[model samples]
Target: MARPDSQLLPLGDFKPSDEWQTHVNAIFYGIKGPEIHHHFQTYVSRDYRLAHALADTFLEEVRKQRLADDTITIQEWGVGNGNLAARFLSRLKSVDAAVYSHIHYTLCDYSEEILNGVRVNPNLQEHEGRYFLKQVNAETQDDFEPHSVHKIISNEIWDDLATSVLLQNNGMLYEEFLQPLLQRNIPNVPWESFVEQFAGKDLDALKKNPPFLEQIVWERSFQRIDISDWPYGTFILKHLDRLADEIPIPINTGAFQTLERAKQLLAENNLGYTSFDYGMLSDHELNLPGRPYYKLYGGQYTSMVNFPLIAEVGKAIGFADVQLEHQHDFVGRNLSENVLSALELVQVHPRISRMEPWDADLLMLQTLQALNASYRSPYKGQMDYPPMPGTPKKQRKQITELARNLSATGVPDTVAYITESEVAESTGRLKKLGYGERDLKNAFDRSTQPIAFGHMTLR
Candidate 1:
């Protein structure tokens, strides 16, 4: 808990946003460790479908390319809870034992805390001999030999890496900078003492105390800056020249570094690098006014992945082919059907837009109930949907009943996707909830957003 509100004290001088982002994330992941999942959600955090889809795609690629080597090397960076790796291996083994026999999977993360935590997950235990864990900071890790890894995949990691925000006014480009300040009072500890502990890297001592990172407040300022010396500066500048002025554009510099590293690490007969993240997919969306460039979750800075820039970076780094599309589209390609996220399907309901928050929650649960019939997930145990605060006692009880009866096999939460056939199976139940067949048909259609889930693959 925070201490009595007090005057904010400057934690440090203003620094470039990317530098500050990297600094804060380094500290956040260092301390939060395994508990980081509580602050943010990733598609693979609880769902098995995405992992299975990726496994299928990789297997198809393996068959087509048919690498001569006896062993297949696949590395997943920024793995969360080891679920994706576990599910992927499970799918591979169940699908084809021969390919699974040659698979050598590696989990890479910057936090030893996270690595240690993933090491003990019961789900990963079944794939004991097939996987290894390595601590790697994406921005500057080079221990792996060039052309060694056959496949590299990451989910929701690029957003946490270093990104710089630029806004052009009257042809003058300005970069965002931020100064960190701490809350005046923090329980029993003095502010200065907190700073001393933070500077000394006494993470263990800090961990035993109240959350210090939560007390941070950002002070933003902008200044003209030079990027001539930065990596891919010329390429980034050329792209920025084509974009409109007065709109802040995020450049994921760290993502560019990761792409470069991926190019170096992937084998000549590789399946290549693929990452799933949330961000803008087109230049038109990036040029829109009032688009958010970054957000903070549990005091960790996360910037949008900037998919368009990433594509350019991938090509500039010598990847032969680069593809960017909606994440559901990527999953759909493997399933041979159109797909929609649970939230997207919920939004397509005819009466949803007119419903109140409580009513909307009810509708969502009903929708999930309808989808649950044939949407059985192979892996379960991550279902928890609490009713909204201020829900009436009767409605709360109704929600509880629905949640209790919700199948362990139900379509997973908002981020998980369901195929068209699954929606077809639920059509009768959905019609009672006022959804028409066309609504179900159009449920497969996804509209582009200023910001949305995106998948990028570089080959």
Candidate 2:
């Protein structure tokens, strides 16, 4: 098969195929519904330290505050699959069963499907009497009661929140671009005509909107791909311009105004919240040189990191304290080294072969640099592998032999790979983005294994 084009594809015809939609829906709702769970799980498991540390810290904070008691209520704004919530509950149960015995959980998400999935977890079945799952949009007030929640947690949810402006831009441009295509009803429209009519117009419109335009130009540019019948390419180019036009400008009065409103809501309720995701220079972290999270997926430069604008609004709204806690501590020390090492030595080696139904599937993902440096595959390889017949014994024997060899040499496969020119290219990209040798070393050290984060709670 032809290599899957990595370039920016047109959103005009970008309706998710049924299978893709299922994947997206499963993720959006936080349901560990097959494909979606596997997609995120590989990275999370490999980065186990990062996941556990964040969850541990958040739960520890709640524990320290003595909020595990029945009277204290915790609500997760974008509680996906209740993973973090489950972890928090487990920790509380371990510390003092009574404290967790009757604790109330309000799990909220935008998708009803996710909310429903939360309601059905077997682990949660015993505690079903104490939990509530609701569909909520963070921008609106109807879904939650004011000043009622003691702690709010969200993980990896804010970045995807559909802002009115984003939707408006998408809807408007989609309508405009599609009108021509739909009118023609041919397989495609002329590339140049599509660009002139939609792409140029959208950019012009954005330029006119000084605030949003400044945000796009100054903040960051997203990944762009060039397609060459690519009438669809031209159409998508127009769509992207529209999307870029929708990005809210930073350092502007209008931007501040929206932030001010968000702050008002947080203050009005006096709620304590924590958010976990990738971003640089948060509203809480002023004057610090912002770091990019992932160079791929639009996080190329310092500005590409998705700033916690909502959390900023919350602080502005008058919360006592607002901060962006780094996941690096977890990512580096705990995930890359400790937790993953433990799993490798214990669970994976001894139990995997003997077990009939293996507990977990494992897969590897290259870092952004590694991916970019390597030959791009048309198919993004599965991050998780399913159990195959008669393979356990062979796999176990191979693993044992590999381990014995590694023990003698004391060198990892990743270390060997890093010596290559391709790895050098990846390391160079990382260095250019402010990552030091230590960072690269940590990345390389952890590359061979899979990592998992325990949970993420956003408030």
Candidate 3:
């Protein structure tokens, strides 16, 4: 977890652990078989206002347009589980009757399994012919007709798209090329069946010219990223000649490509689109502490969007208005104030918390984040629990004594040396101390302040 400039250990110092991400994620995401959504659920927010926000904005555009035959075509890109589509369609029906009646709402996804869920959904089923299911790849959007759709929207999807891991060293950029290491001559070989899909291609050689995965021109290895190729090349060099510092960036080329494709697919008459993804608004936050800009979730790769680039690209593509804002601000402006106030009240009050399962999960995550900041390594008491302000003193004393025992008896070495069994034992002790399931989880959970949601619109 050291900074980019920490040290150097010649080339090919250490090969990375076997992982499936980026374009390789296609293997796991039902491109071969079994849709990814069947196992991995990303649509945790069903009844939330952000879902309504996207639908509401789409409706706004629908209302603004001059209708010819009193109809409009709206499509959603990368429709995973179709919860958002069902939710949005239901919300649209309740909000605007005029737009909902003449709407051709299409759910676009690459996986037939995913689109099947959309077809069976009770909420979407109510819409009937108005709702069409289209199996299309977001990368090429091959099935879609340009200037045929009125509005396009995606939620938490751009990150799931193909991305390029990059690095900056000595004022130049390089792409991180990943080579999947497969076990050879081993019992119950991992990915044996999947690797068999590629005819006449060695696993090692596939790293350079992958059939499914993407690899840039020049590759350099450091930590998990390999950065050697610079797409900008002489262009970037000329620009850097007038600049001060060369910022290290993990560019999401796939997202940029998607945006460019969206521009083509959108109608020429004030085509409107909204993309809501968790990303960084500035380069300064790229390498900051407590910032997980890039993360691996459920074996799929996701990276923080360089939102400014989206806006600039949108402007270049003749978008009359391109705006980027935090999700909190966008949601606040569109949603009722009472909803946010109620959430804040619940956070401050000790009474009943009406948060859903996802909210509770968020709370525990916040607590653990705070705990990380409070205590350093070698302290075995570094466990996740409820905040002290909310818990009673008796329970607090029990936790303190448990911490003392862990610090004394547990590994006297660093955090890395701490065993999984030791941590599990500490968790068991917390349960015995009479802390409820939710309370135990709340100990270190701080508010989601550091976690900022990025919202961008192209119109």
Q: Which number leads on TM-score?
A: 1
Q: Model 2, 381-453: lDDT tens per residue? A: 2122334445477565543443333222221221111222333455655454444555434443433111122
Which portions of model 2 miss their true places by more than 4 Å?
1-35, 42-70, 163-271, 282-305, 308-312, 330-459
Ranking by TM-score: 1, 3, 2
Q: Which portions of model 1 show Cα errors greater than 4 Å?
A: 1-4, 199-201, 212-215, 349-362, 386-401, 434-440
TM-score of each: 0.91, 0.46, 0.62
The sequence of per-residue lDDT tens digits that candidate 1 reaches over residues 189-297 is: 6667767766665667667667768678989988997778878889888989888998888999899889989989998889999999998899988988888888888
Residue 121 in candidate 1, Cα distance off native in Å: 1.9
* Candidate 1 Cα RMSD after full superposition onto the native fold (Å): 2.8
* Candidate 3 error regions (>4 Å): 1-20, 31-45, 182-194, 198-248, 287-290, 338-451
How would you encode candidate 3's per-residue C-alpha lDDT over 1-459 as one tens digit per residue? 744333221212223212224434554344422245433334212233566677787777665666524667777887765767776777777887667788787878776656666677675677786788888887667577778877787877777776555455565554455544322322122334334542233333333322232211112354433232443333334433432333334455566667777878787764478787876664445444456545654445566665655565566566778888776566556744212211232244232366543444334333223223322332122333232455556655555554343433222211111122222334544344333546434422334443446778887
Cα lDDT, model 3, residue 429: 41
Task: Locate the minimum summed-lDDT window of 10 residues in model 3.
Answer: 412-421
RMSD (Cα, Å) for all candidates, in order, is 2.8, 15.7, 13.7
Candidate 1 achieves a global lDDT of 0.85
